[model samples]
Target: MEVVNQFVVSPCVSVCEVDERDICVGCLRTLDEIARWGVMSHEERMHVMTELLPLREAGDVT
Candidate 1:
């Protein structure tokens, strides 16, 4: 049997802190999402990335 390996990039911009909106401005991810990323499904991570892309385009970096 072969195992399917999925991978993702770390969203670290140096500063690590969760904002009032529960999203990490640096990584554009929610604190809970970040904590559970390693075990999250590929589809779930993709969803997070989709949510992040717009914020990045909007210059919402931290």
Candidate 2:
């Protein structure tokens, strides 16, 4: 039997606090996105990662 493992890495960065906009101060991911990470596919995870960089650069951090 062949075992296929699909893994999507998280960019938690160990700072797990949410800002006023409900976005994580560490990863800049919303509460919903963080919650859905486990079930999200590799593509979905990559999409979210791609979206986060802009938000982080826009000063989403606290």
Candidate 3:
């Protein structure tokens, strides 16, 4: 068996303020996402960092 280590870092930019929509203005994560980040799996964190955050930044997602 191979042991693989995976680490997904948080996207917090130290702004730490939610907008009117309850999305973080710095990291572009929803309040729920932020709250669940620590408990989320590696894949989930990657999804947020790679897919979701980009869409949010591009205004493709609300």
Candidate 4:
């Protein structure tokens, strides 16, 4: 038997404050994303970590 463990780490840095745009200044996640993190699937989390967060950080996203 083989076991595969999948864990999606949170980007929170303890700076829990949302900007005027409702994005977290610490983790760079939007308020909705942060609120939904606990219930989001692995793929969803990956999208946030890989795509959304990067775009947000780069100022490409709102």
> In model 1, how large is the Cα lDDT of residue 27?
77
- lDDT per residue as tens, model 2, 7-26: 76788899999988888888
Instruction: Please give, for residues 12-51, the per-residue lDDT of candidate 4 as tens digits.
Output: 9999998999999999998889999999999999999999
lDDT of 2 at 15: 96
lDDT of 2 at 43: 82
Using lDDT as the yardstick, the better of models 1 and 4 is 4
The C-alpha RMSD of each candidate to the native structure, in angstroms, is: 4.0, 4.1, 1.2, 1.4
State the TM-score for model 4. Answer: 0.90
| Model 1 per-residue lDDT tens digits across residues 1-53 | 99867676766676788777777767777788789989998888877777664
Q: Clash pairs of candidate 2?
A: none
lDDT of 3 by residue, 1-62 (tens): 99878788899989999999999999999999999999999999999999999999999997
What TM-score quantifies how close candidate 3 is to the native fold? Answer: 0.90
How does candidate 4 score on lDDT? 0.92
- Compute the lDDT of residue 59 as modeled in candidate 4: 98
Query: What's model 3's lDDT at 14?
Result: 100
Q: Whose lDDT is greatest here?
A: 3
